[model samples]
Target chain A: MRNRSILIISLPLLIATLLVVMSLSITLGSASVDWQTVWRVIFSKITVINQWVEPDWADTTETIVWDLRMPRVIQGAIVGSALALAGAIYQGVLRNPLADPFILGVSSGASFGAALVFALGWQIMWLGQFTLPVVAFLFGFGSLMLVYFLARVGNKVRMETIILAGVVVQAFIGACLSLVMALANEQLQTIVFWMMGSLSLTEWSYNYVVFPIIAIIAIISLFFARELNMLSLGEEIAHHSGVSVSRTRFYLLILASVMTGAAVSVSGAIGFVGLVVPHIVRLIVGADYRLILPLSIIGGAIFLVGADTFARTILAPREIPLGVVTAFLGAPFFAYLLRRAKREYF
Target chain B: MLTISNVYKHLERKQLLNEVSFNVGNGRCVGLIGPNGAGKSTLVKLISGLEEPSGGTIKIMGKDIRQWSVKKLAQKVSVLTQDGLSPYPISVFDAVLMGRYPHLSFFQREGKRDIQRVEEVLEFTGLADFRDQMLDTLSGGERQRVAIAKAMVQEPELLLLDEPTTYLDIGYQMNVLNLVKDWQERESLTVLMVLHDLNLAAQYCDELILMDEGSIVKRGTSEEVISAQMLKEVYHASPEIVRHPKLNIPQILL
Candidate 1:
């Protein structure tokens, strides 16, 4: 009861934090816009309680706020949330805390797809098109299916087998991506940038692609939150508790794959947000998936928004890849968690 | 009521349980006693539908277990396997509440009744004070009790326990056994427990089934099954069986 109440209270606090971080992220970007102007632009559009008027700055503010910053921030939130949600579900389904969005080789597969496009100069053939993201999503999902098939042993797939199979597939795909990178010429930098992950290229159209897919998958994943909780106890226990272990696991894997594929398609290969966000949330709130899933979504959004804000502001006009910022911040926290983990926690 | 007939369990071509059969009546505590690796846990697993018997059938309350849905089976029987640990940190209260999973829909959160049931189980298991504590931080006995609380929250008609007290001190062992006995009497539950301690089984179990080589060697009242001859043949231990001076129950002297 108390835990439920705490969750009820913390949810709003988390949302409020996300909102504040989002506002700051919008205001602190390369445009050098002050908070007052940003607020005026936002409030004038959102509400009539405008204390200040920006008559001449409206178009510029509108372009900055609505056209550029809003989409980027929203994409960051969606990508981060997708990664974290996928990580949480994978960790639960696989019974491995270290499992993340890339455990099924989806990121590497997406990298392979994007690398292919870059190597073939397809983006030049079809400039300003959605082909790259679409291809990335297909390859990401395809690799996941391939890994799933390879991991199956007779009738059932053990957690160890899945992890080991994923590792092998990941290594194989990584090799392929490297080979693609080597074959490419002047476009190597662009391919590497995509591989490293970024939200800088996000546009308003990207939101149309990311939001509906993520929102639908997120809602579906949340419905299975209780099943995930039972699954963490182990497959047999979950089965005895009326959960169809195989079906639940398959759906969870697919959900995680779709979410990860979508996120990777947009942001490339952002690491650690998926892995670290859920674990940090688990530490604060216990391992109730009902609590963990939603909190992870909010936490992921807030974390990336905060990180993206820092990334944009830290270098003034220049922007750091969101992946770099996430890794820089997440690695230390992960290290601390490892150091603090009890002996048997492994 | 539960019935197992001609159950065969094979692991890697080795027969763990070969043609084992048993009948458990309603409101009865049936003790399954055996040495290590004697397929006692396997029997529990088979009955709980955790594993399919290689060839045979299990019936629970006049219905074949295979015909029952997982949720229906869960509502009928709850199994507590030995020393099952959660890999992640979960609070005792939430862990106990997991017993309600079989009773809940996919998107259903634990309502007030579920919370009340969890609180009752916590209080009954003496874990009310530790409700907020993480399971990883608990002592062995406390962890075992939490497991029991989880099982109890299911409110099952038939309870299957696989070495429920394997890791506890003597005090906790007694506490757990006493609690099971108390619940059995109060709730009229049918219990099937795999126990290593012959003495405790002899003391608490109304009837005991002694298993050797994955088959029942002897089964009767505690006095009938705990005989010196049966102990020597089954356990290969030359122990003397005597009636307890105070409780008038059979006691094994090793």
Candidate 2:
């Protein structure tokens, strides 16, 4: 009961924080725009109840807010929510608290695809656009199938074997990626930069592709939250408690991996949001996935926005990679949480 | 009522349970007693529908076990496997509330009655004070009691207990078995419990099935099956068979 009330209060508080952070992020870009102007521009764009005269805003400010920063911030929030939701699902399905979105080799597969695109100079576009992200998503999905097949032992797929198989596949893919980078005459720096992960190129087009897919998948996952709780009880007990163990595990793996693949395809394998946000939410909400899933979504969006805000402003104009910023910020916070947590909650 | 006939369980080529058969009547506490490797646990698994029989049938109340869906079977039956630490830090109330899983729809949260049922069971098991405690925070005995509370909330017609008391002091052992015994009598619950301790089995069970080598060697009242000769032959243990002076039941002195 106390937990439920805490969740109730945290929900609105998190929303308020997200709003404040997002508005602050909108105003803190390379362009110097006043806070009131930023708010007016945003409020005027929305289809509010009353009709108002258009605010006389500068074309540059409008372009920067709508074209440049708006999509980036929204994409960051979406990707953050997707990655964290995937991470929470993986942890619950595998019954390992350490499991992350990339534990199944999705990130490695994505990196390999991106490397191939960069090294081969493959301009092969998909429907005349987004060749790299499309390829990356396909490779990530294909990697999941490969890991699943490799992990299967007769009728059952043990979690340990799946994790080990993922590690093996990831290592092999990493070697291939390195070979690509080593052989490429030039564009080596470009490959390395992309491999490090960035959201600088986020646009409304990318958002259009990623948002629906992730939002749909994440919502579908919420329905299975109870099944996820059953699964974490260990397989045999879960089966006895009316969970169709094999079927539930299969569906959850597919859903989580697909979401992770989508996020990685867009964000170039952003790390730590998936790993860190879920842990933080779990600490606050306890282990009930019903609460944990939605909270992780909101909390993840807030976390990445904050992290990306820091990444851009800390250096100003020369931005560090998103993955680096997340790891730098997430690792220390995770460590403090580990120290503060006295009992094993997972 | 539960019935098992010609149940054969084989792992690869090795036989775990070979042609085991037994019957447990309604409201009766039946103890499956045997030494290690006798497949008592395997038989319990088969009856609970956790494992399929190689060549036989298990029927609950008249319907074949295979006919029931997993969820329906869960509603009718509950099993408590050997105690292990819970991987998640589930609260005691929520842990017991999981017993209502089979009864709940996919989107339905636990209703008021469900929570009330859990509260009653927690109180009945003397775990009311520990209701908000993390399951892992409790001692071994308390965790075992939590397991019982979880299972009892299922309101199962048949309860299958696998090694309900393996590592515990005498007080805990009796506390667990006594709770089962009281529930059995009050609700007319059919019990098929696998017990490692011979004396406790002989004391608590209404009927005893002595098993050896994945087969039932003897099945009868405590006095008929727990003889010194049978113990030496089946268990390979030399034990003196005596009587409980107060209850007038057979007791094994090892």
Two-chain DockQ for model 2:
0.62
lDDT agreement of model 2 with the native: 0.86
Q: What is the C-alpha lDDT profile of model 2 across B98-181, one tens digit per residue?
A: 889999987787899998999899889899999988876777888888888888999999999999789778999999899988
Interface quality of candidate 1 as DockQ: 0.53
TM-score of chain B of 2: 0.97
Backbone clash pairs for candidate 2 read none
What are the chain A TM-scores of the candidates, in order?
A: 0.93, 0.96
Leading candidate by DockQ: 2
DockQ of each: 0.53, 0.62
- Identify the runs in model 2 with alpha carbons over 4 angstroms from their true place: A123-126, B84-87
Tens-place lDDT digits, model 1, residues A69-153: 9888999899989999999999888988889999889999999999998889776445367778888999999999889999997
lDDT of 2 by residue, A1-346 (tens): 7557877998899988888888788899778677777777777778862157376887888888888888888888888889999999999999888899999999899989988988887878554468888888998888888999999987678999999999999999999989998998697887787777788878799999999999999998999988887777778788788887877898999999999999888888888888889999887667888788989998889888888888888899899988899999999999999899877767
Candidate that would win on lDDT: 2
